[model samples]
Target: MASEGSTPQQLSDDFTDLQKKLQVVIEARQRLDAQLSENQAVQKEFAELDDDANIYKLIGPTLIKQDKDEAVMNVDKRLDFIDKEIKRIEAQIAEYSENSEKKKAEIMRLQMEQQQQQQQQQQGPA
Candidate 1:
C-alpha cells in the first residue's frame, strides 16, 4: 500500500529504481571477485618461493629488489585485505538480491490491483 493515492506510474518508477540499485551491487560484486582471484594467485606464488630465492617487486615501470621475508609478509597482508573486501561485497549483493525480489513482488501486486480497479470502473455500478 502506497498511502492514500500513489498511482501505478509511481509504483513503476520505484520498481525501476530498485532494479538499477540491484544491478549496481551485482557489478561491484563481480569486480571484487576478479580482484580477489588475482590477489589469491599472488599469495600462492609468494608461498611457493624458496627462502634463498631473489625477489623483485614491480614499482611503477621498474622492478625493485625486495627482501624475501618482506615480500611474503606483504602478500599475506594483501590477501587478508582482499578476502575481507570480497566478503563485504558479497554481503551487499545478498541484501540487494533480497530487496529486488521483494520489490518485484510488490510491483506485480500493484499492477494487478490497478487492473481490477480499471475493470470495475469500466463496468460502472452493479
Candidate 2:
C-alpha cells in the first residue's frame, strides 16, 4: 500500500519505471535465449565432424586453418559458457517477471482506491 502523502502521480511514475525495467529484462532474456540456441547448434555440428576432418576459422577477412581437435575444444568451451549464461539469464527473467506482476497488482489497487475516493467526494453529505 502507498504511504500517506503519496500522490497518484508518484505512483504512476513508479509503475512506469517498473514497466520499462521489465521490458529491458525481457529483451535481454530474448537475446540470451537466441545466443543459447545458436551455440547449441554449433556444438552439435562440432560433434558430427570426423576425427581427421579439417577446420577453418574466419579471422577478420582471412580463413585460418585450425586443427580439428582444437576447433572442437574451442566450440565445446564456448558451448559450456553459453549454457551457464543462459541459465543465469533465465533466473533473472523469472525474478523480474515476479516483480512485474507485483507492481501491476499494486497499480491496480492504487487506482481502485483513488476511484473510491473520487466517488466519495461526488456523493457529498452522505
Best by lDDT: 1
Each model's backbone clash number = 0, 0
**Over the full model, what C-alpha lDDT does candidate 1 score relative to the true structure?**
0.79
Superposition error at 5 for model 2 (Å): 4.8
TM-score of each: 0.83, 0.82
Model 1, span 53-122: residue lDDT tens: 8999999999999999998898788778878877887888787677667767777887788899999999
Tens-digit lDDT string for candidate 2 (6-74): 676876777677678778877877887787788778778878988787779999999999998888788
Candidate 2: worst 10 consecutive residues by lDDT?
Answer: 1-10
- Candidate 2 has an lDDT of 0.78
Instruction: Name the 10 consecutive residues with the lowest summed lDDT in model 1.
Output: 1-10
Question: What's the TM for model 1?
Answer: 0.83
Q: Candidate 1: deviation at residue 120, Å?
A: 1.1
